[model samples]
Target: MRLRNKPWAKDKLDQYPQYVISGPELLKGKWNGVFDKVQPIHIEIGTGRGRFVTEMAKANPEINYLGIEVQQSVIVTALDRLIEAELPNIKLLNVNAGDVTEFFEKGEVERIYLNFSDPWPKSRHAKRRLTYKTFLKQYEEILINQGEIHFKTDNQGLFEYSLKSFSEYGLLLQYVSLDLHNSNFEGNIMTEYEEKFSKKGHRIFRSEVKYR
Candidate 1:
């Protein structure tokens, strides 16, 4: 979906320095200091409208959740949700996911969430997929040893491709669900895309893969 530009979005994000972090690269390894309490950090790479991250923060107060979304207009909607949530354990980063390693140090993150990412189905665009080998390497660098990546998508092709990529990268598959909502999995937090797709009877694929 093409996002309509919000002229006021940048100013709104700048106004809330507490919720929307600026100059995230400066905080690189010192992320723990940003929150009121030092805790394990988990980040959602493309935190669309902030529903999943905010809900997760509400459910897991002991953990800190950092939401990364590159688009200013899209992230501004998320910022609005965060403002209403008023959760101290959550923060937003309006930066590109491709540059993630620059903002985090080795073992700085405990977990990563890839929820309903763009499929990028063309063969030539395979590398642009979030589960591509290049991205896996970046995720491995910032995540702790044995750190897990929880992924969900309504696109079967992307799920299958990601599984193969994870296997090739030597990641251990902890769980896999072909039809997530129909499966017995518990504590599922649905993203905006997930909800829309599932409501249309789409099968949701989910997996948990851990680093070696």
Candidate 2:
């Protein structure tokens, strides 16, 4: 799906510096200082429209949530949700996921969330997938020892590939569900994509992998 460019999105994002952080790299290891309360940090990469992260923040007040999205238009929608939610534990990052390491120091993050990320199905583009080894290595760098990555997707191929990738990277798979909504998993917040796909009878695959 092509994202329509919003010419005024940048200005809107600038207006809410408290919600959408700027120059995140400057904060690096000092992320806790910016939040209302210093707490375990969990980040959602490709946090489209902010549904999952915002809901997560509302559900878990003790943990700070960061929603990262590269596109200004997409993230602007998330900013709107943040503005309405007015949750003190959530912040947004309008930056590329590839540069995540630049904004976080080693062991700065306790958890990472990947939800319905672009599959990048072609073999040549495998490296671009968020679950690819390259990206996993980046996650490993900033994540605390035994930090967990919770991933969800409707694409079976990507799920299978990610399982192999996570295992090969030596992450211990603590949980796996081929059909998440039907499983016993509780408190599962649905992303916009997840809701749409599941309504169409798509099976949502989920996994929890820990870097030990």
Candidate 3:
């Protein structure tokens, strides 16, 4: 998807300071206090349009949600959606997922969600894939013991490669589903991309992996 540069995106986000943490001091090791509760923090990387994280916050009010999107224009749509929803348990971050540990403290996050992330199908670009071992190792620094990575994608090649990547990094895999919508998995939330792809008769793959 081609991203339109929204010149006013940052200004729009500034209007919702309560939902978007700006300063570095406000974030570092203080994420729990931002929500004014010590609930489990769950972050969704590459939260395009914010459908999945927004719905997850609505469905699980006890869990706090933070969405990270590197694209300013993409995050604007999500921030707008979140503002309209009036969800207090969710926040948005317009930054790279690779810089997660910079904002969050070690063991600060309980779960991470990677929904329909970029496939980066080219073998040469494997390191850029969200499920790559390098990224997983970074996640391990901030995630609590046994914290899980819940992943869903329509690309079979990425899914297969991710399985190997997670295993190679010593993650215990569970809830593996070749076709998520056709399976018995409960509490499945549909992302914007997931809905679009599934409507086109594409199979959605899902799995859960935790650091071993």
Q: How close is candidate 2 to the true structure, as a TM-score?
A: 0.99
The digit string of per-residue lDDT tens for model 3 on 131-184 reads: 988899889999999999999999999999999999889999977999999998
Query: Where does the lowest 10-residue lDDT sum fall in candidate 1?
Result: 93-102
lDDT of 3 at 1: 75
- Models 1 onward score TM values of 0.99, 0.99, 0.97
lDDT of each candidate versus the true structure: 0.95, 0.96, 0.90
Distance (Å) between predicted and true CA of 114, model 2?
0.4
Ranking by lDDT: 2, 1, 3
The root-mean-square deviation over C-alpha atoms between each candidate and the true structure, in angstroms, is 0.6, 0.6, 1.1
Off by over 4 Å in 3: 24-26
Instruction: Flag clash pairs in model 3.
Output: none
